[model samples]
Target: MSKIIKKIFISTIMVSTTFSLLMGAESIEISPSIDKKIFHEQYVSVTVKLNNKNISKVLIVTDKNEHYPIELTTQCDNVCSKIIKLRLGENSIRVEGYIGEELAYEVKNELYCASQAFREYKEAPIKYKERFFHTDKNEKLCAECHDMSNNEQKKVAFVDVKDSNCFVCHKAITLDRYAHAPSANWLCTSCHTGEIENKSKNIIEKSKFIAPKQIASACFSCHDKNKQSWDTKKHKHFPVEAGMCTRCHNPHSSDNKMFLRVNSSFLCLECHADKKLSQQIRGNSKCPGEQKDGCTECHNPHASDYRFLLKSPHVDKKIDNNIKGK
Candidate 1:
């Protein structure tokens, strides 16, 4: 019985020694460090460390789409350190260790990588930012659709006005739809000079001019032909001459047809206070008094060669030729 006990103890000790030797033969340790945050389109370096003497192979697992690993190997007496170069975007890196016939352990480093491309880019030409104007998300001007040349004058005007920030707030105006060419080379500053007021009490005020009719002047800058035609007609509205085009026309595209502030006869009657003329119109005659045939039967919203803002020859001789002709 003693002989049997001694034999069993010897067998157990041998088994323990063999297991320790096997573990030591295939030992591997890895240390990985990466940036906490990454921007779009940037490079990242992953550092790896191992403890085994004869490492046959090392594999790094990452997303197939974004990063391709560039393997770098450095060897010391018994240890090795590797640097893997990774491309931008989000990816994960896992280091695999291998011996001659045994699969060791794996160390995983997960990271979110992004491209830093946008940080070095310039501001878009048509970019606009408005805090209180829009309830929706602020619209950014993308250079994709906006014209860079049209913004040159606006840029200069911004500099002259000393409110370079204005370009940042107003949407870029396109010249594609203009009926005529722009007059006064880069003339935005000539009309919009007084809109921004200096609030600083320390600086002496330069001038106390009425706000230049920015909206009207903007229209006439390109539509000088329309302005001249309208001015030649009789019964011209004072605001049109005063450069208050926005009182009737919206600069931006509108759901309302003709880009008028309000649609239909109500748009006309808003200022045309004649009560008798309001009652005669058949469709949507919401005006207060007796409307005549229609507002357009007499007046031209834009411009006409005739007096009293008439677009065409009037039907009735009494109203058209006799009464108003005088």
Candidate 2:
């Protein structure tokens, strides 16, 4: 009789343990599963579904350092379901369910914030439109893939393509370098189109692409008529022969007017190398033997309305003619 009592007691203990494990498993269901790569600053919503109608009260606990807990209650007939919003960095949620005054089940599972889920979602889309702008063979080909049926979306894509395609070809040059290049920034695209089979096979074809004369033509694309008129003048700077605008002028701003690379006399002395010219000008005295005399007293670096880049009173034609007559 004592042996029968002992066996019955052991069986009862086993049954209680099995019941407790099953109830613990059924207390919560979290979706999307858990993993690493969860960040601390994202918002998340967690839902808990209760198993037995007898379970009336639920208590939740989390690590206070990472997340704040928010209590949620939903009514259904006589029973209430509870949800707790928890923000935990490296802690688990503990859920304790109670029936009236008795504890029904105690369960725990790891918690993850929404930031991890968002990162995974972002990675899943391989071709996100926000990051890459697409182009085609004619380079007008974005309309083929973009949604043409939707007018608003089509306009947005067209604007993005127009603005971003320049960067695609000119990526090799930094903005500062482009700004200071002999031909200004906007004209870089007219010549260096990146297409294969041109005389310059591509933008990378150094020997053909960096030809000084072709770079000059890039400026003439907009200024051809102006250059043609200037060429008619008898005296011209040698940069006209070498096709080098940067020889006389910095394409960007300068402390001196007319965008000349230096003050007038210093600029002329670059080629003249005359010690008298430097000494005469360095003393802040006027140029010798002429009124309003300076480098501009004689020559024009660029084509001039007057004979020598000169202002009104100095625009004389007979000075050189009379000197030759002597």
Reference-based lDDT, each prediction: 0.44, 0.45
Model 2 bad stretches (over 4 Å): 1-187, 191-214, 251-259, 275-284, 288-298, 304-326
Best by TM-score: 1
Instruction: Tell me the TM-score of each prediction against the true structure.
Output: 0.34, 0.33
User: Candidate 2: how many backbone clashes?
Assistant: 1
Candidate 1 structure quality by residue, lDDT tens digits, 1-326: 69999999999998876556445523544422342333211233333455665667666666553333324344233334333445444456666665655546455554443321122221212222111211112112222222322234442333243233323223223122331112213333444443533433332322221233336755666678987877777656655765667556544434455555445456566556474353555457363222644566566766665655566655334355556766
Per-residue lDDT of candidate 2, residues 159-263 (tens digit): 333344333333323222223432233333344433333443433313212234234565576569968977776545566655566456544434456555556
Q: Superposing every Cα of model 1 onto the true structure, what RMSD results?
A: 21.0
